[model samples]
Target chain A: MAKSKSRTEAPQDASEDVVMQELPTSHQPDVQDDASMAEVDAEDDAEVEDEEEIEDDTQRVRLLPGSTPTAASFEFLNEGHTLGNALRYIIMKNPDVEFCAYAIPHPSEPKMNVRIQTYEGTTAIEALQKGLKDLQDVCDVVSDKFVAAQKDFKKKSISS
Target chain B: MDYDPMAMDEIESKGPVIKISQADTVRVKFELSNADISFANSLRRVMLAEIPTIAIDLVEIEDNSSVLADEFIAHRLGLIPLNAEGIEELQYSRDCDCEEYCDHCSVKLTLHARCTGDENMQVVARDLVPSGDRINRVLGTPIINESSDGLGPLIMKLRPGQEIKLQCIAKKGIAKEHAKWAAPSAIGFEYDPHNKLHHLDMWYETDAKLEWPPSEYADWEEPPQEGERFDFNAVPDRFYFNVETAGNIPPDAIVTEGIKVIQQKLASMIHDLGETEGGENGDYNGPRSPEYNGGGDGWQDQGFTTPYGNGGNQSAWGGGAGGTTPYGTTPYGGAGAGNGGW
Candidate 1:
């Protein structure tokens, strides 16, 4: 289940189109050069982002049985949304979700950087649905990159 | 508080103190019509109610169940369900309950060992119950929960041929010091091909919570071993129906459909027995056996209408029915035309 960190960064530099072209061989792509490049980019992004307003957009929720939402301070996110607007809209719906600022490219939708955050004990499916609904409910959302997707059990189980 | 050097030394010398040690038991003395029904469910429920802990480690396979040979076989061989009942023992993870012994909660081991051992052992409960400890080892894992102080990890070993026993001790409470024991509740079944009615009875000895009026005819007997032919009529009302889950097919499964129907009826009978209320013995005090019905003539009404009729008057697998044979005559009566047919 464990893969070398060195082999998972080439496509990060390549645009979604380039990555898509290499999708067939994505599983075993060259990672040494890409990983080093990713490390450098991450460092650069970290410095710039630390200096700027620290917009903690990341959220995480424990997927468990019989967990309910409490003290709503953060909203959910989903697909079909204007970029920045969805994040802000989700925050409005759930005023309780604290921002950690960890964002990653949506696995299916590369154009958008999806923020990952945590929530209280709740089913992964329910949490994702709520996040998606919130993202779609907001108006005047923008799109430098806008996409939403929930974690799927199939992918997690297979990979793990 | 005062401390005694000698006492302290004694305590230290007893390394890895098994403060909470028990042997709780659940003996299911039962009777059932040799029918094939979901008896496995009943076995599971009884195990759960009693053991409540001890993660099942492993189950061995032995024999399958069959309806032939006038006997019943368990579902599996060796140990049917590897992790059947052992979760509770893991919960007894505390000190002794006595003045310093284990008490109400601690390391609990639940064990369920069945007679039959040749079937695919299904996992009925997996860490189903937990301990009442405030601190848990694994958090966020499927088995352990951090919120309520009950769920705890289980680490114990169990193998085949051993009487399945779940033992535990109280963690910090007074109950920990006290040793308790439990055995699997006894269960049995019987099938009458003639009446086509399966009769089952399940019994257990419990603290005097209710009084069970005893029936003079409280016929309890031991079940037959594998491949043994049992006089279905002679099977008492309360015998252990030894079943195998793997090695050999239980004699009861030979007549699959009949046994299945009988199993359903037996399950209901057990439920009824559980619901019976009265006395501490779990049985009411009354004339033991039913009024001795004169001779074997009344056997048909009692659900044993086979070619040889009820087993009361016959011996060994019914002598192929009573026939009027004068001088060396060929057997030509009842279902004897062919060697079998009920």
Candidate 2:
């Protein structure tokens, strides 16, 4: 039975492999047919290269050049408001953080640049790590409560 | 301010608490107290978009004589929720090492329907056959017959002599990519029932209560009396959530999964921060070391040697939090495992 199934699906699988390989290059001619479209494609290609470069580098978090550890703008690749806003909130809760804010340079780009200025006692990197730890603790508490509540609900429902 | 014993007791009892008021297979209503607005909103957004589910992603039609266009049927197929009981075991198609798709990453479902008699025939999700035992259509109570096998969502109808043959590949994905993979049909989040924080401006003709009636949840707390003084310093710390699942997963599992997603995201960020090279003033030339290309294998190796030198034991992080790799099955290969750090 397994052999029969594989035999029937063999042709379909081969065709799909071809389709996958052709997918990226198939749209190139359509864009090149028009001059303005070609220009837009070129710009898009440059943006893709930028994204690739960011991805290729193992260091997702980088300290911007010409910035001090105490006051710096750190670039976080492949992150958006989900992490940015939450991190900002957690960092701001600390008394040593003088200023903290995050901004996405562009909407299309998956990058979040956070600027942090801390008081003389602490550095921005330390504050950021503390914020991440605090946020994880918060999530742990929430998850535990949720699981306990769910169990209680289940028991009550079964008893009733 | 003096430290009063009564206030201290109040503070001790105010630690985070979750109360489940209602729960069933497909719906759950719960209250989360003592968490700030940021945490509550984050959980809600993650549940709606981040938690992964299985859905028909690619469809190939071999023959279709039905009135509907092939694209229309394919789009409808993508919306049907498949059982995702063990979806975490399945790797994402993009992350899997296959040319197109394999059983490890995708489930093949085929449907062949042909009508011959004079009567019209109806095609439903039950007719589609799955290639593997792990995935199948979510079957709810039958609308027509109670004793019959639970019915699935209707796919299409066919007239006499009309036929439709198709093959669909179901893959695991998050709602962030497409709504078809959304875990919940609707998630109702409410906070500040009395509006003491004035988050919303109540617009009404004469009486605010008459036009905008309070939800049933408002009864959980005392309703504000007429001309009652409001505390401006009060911040909304309690959140109420009503989650209705799309039947791909259980209601409680969705909440836990969402929380896990948030934890994994934070863990990966922290892990990356630990590997960052340049913190010295005026020394950022963009990660000069070509050896640490941030590929899956490179980071996996580095996690063992320099496992968060500053941050204590990597295992203490999100690694054992859920007993699963933080980004083990994540769609983005860049975010996956680094030794003890999930």
Candidate 3:
């Protein structure tokens, strides 16, 4: 049932051909995750008490089966860096953005949440990506021009 | 270190696709297939460590009679994020050949505030005059002070007869070295296709499956949408990034440069790891022994079991790290026979 029949049938008694025919080609060194490989997320009660001190890390935010492919959001802890007007100014420039806004929900926690919404044809993320790209372009142009102007000023100053 | 670059499809997606963005805050979502938490976390790490920006590095206080100490004023000067307009022209002080600093490696900002007469004026970032006509000319406006809309956040109040003279040094650096050097205030990501959680006919707010990030949707109390309990696409591999900039270099530059830097680092790592540990650590990982794969037990999963071969024997190598050449299966492509074989 082999497609390539003319690959030369192994000589009946040839050890080299015998070894070649039995060679395993998809060798993957198994990674070790003692905790995970031992059991899945839903802990089996009988074997659950192994790592008592280590807190079980429960992950959320996964788009499970039967979930909508519509939207996504994220929260970032403000480490004292909130370029509020500047970032908003940049994101709003994108034409594909259907809805987007940033808000600070907590007074105690230094955090801000930014939500970017998109139209039917585009996803919310793509709009943010486009906006980010635009910002990059603007920054790059500014960087290049600043350098060029610096060079010009240096050259002119030296001659005078 | 154990990441499989090939298994990631989020890297191949077209757009992060902005969904909703408010002034100063934006939410973006993208997809990733066959990838995990490491992918998203790595981007955050890169933004925190890789993207370069300019900030005040050194401050020489000539005279200070203000309430703040000399060290405090210097520290304040260091926190100020300058206009990273001509950063491409600047080099890191660590990389530059100059002994201390030059125009190519650093920018100088000098501030001399003397409260003369009777008026007690506040010495602010605007009062700090940046030198180098090149940077100032391109900036067209104040480098750091005027751009950021706050009077006291980065300002120092001075009273009458309180004189402050200082020379500030600006240099290129990444956030990894110091928080003051970081470009982004906050940057994070999450798996996309945000589906609703449900239990016993009741729609829950957050999912418990994905770790590192709990349901971001749970944080807000918004009106439920139609079919919140229905799942359209269960497996979402999209990567959503929320980046808040610190206001100098912007967010997009941070994202683009972060990815580029991470790629460069990975490529360098591969190159560095490819060579043998022969020069110094020869004994630990010297030439391979002939009996290394003696029993041939390791060969079983080396490649795919090709049907074209005689019997159920031959295993053709599939694509993997460094990639397998099209010669059936064996890890010893170059090290075969007498070629570095012991």
DockQ of each: 0.01, 0.17, 0.01
- For all predictions in the order shown, the interface RMSD in Å is 32.5, 12.1, 18.3
TM-score of chain A for each candidate?
A: 0.27, 0.63, 0.49
lDDT against the true structure, per candidate, is 0.27, 0.72, 0.49
Candidate 1 lDDT over residue span A1-160, tens digit each: 2355534554464433231322333353443465545577779677656633322321122111111122111111221122223333333234233332223234454232223233555322233344443333211120100111012322444597
Candidate 2 lDDT score at position A27: 29
TM-score against truth, every candidate: 0.16, 0.73, 0.45
Top lDDT model: 2
Q: What fraction of the true Cα-Cα contacts (under 8 Å, chains A to B) does candidate 1 also have?
A: 0.00
Score candidate 1 by TM-score against the native. 0.16
lDDT, model 3: 0.49
Error of 1 at B120 (Å): 42
Candidate 3 C-alpha lDDT tens digits along B141-172: 23443345554245587888898888888888
Name the better of 1 and 3 by TM-score.
3
Per-residue lDDT of candidate 2, residues B228-315 (tens digit): 8877667777799999886778888899999999999889878877766443434432343223223223233332212221122222
Q: After superposition, how far is residue A102 of candidate 1 from its true place, in Å?
A: 43
| Deviating ranges (above 4 Å) for candidate 2 | A1-58, B1-14, B132-149, B277-342
Question: Regarding lDDT, does 1 or 3 come out ahead?
Answer: 3
The candidate that achieves the highest DockQ relative to the unseen native structure = 2
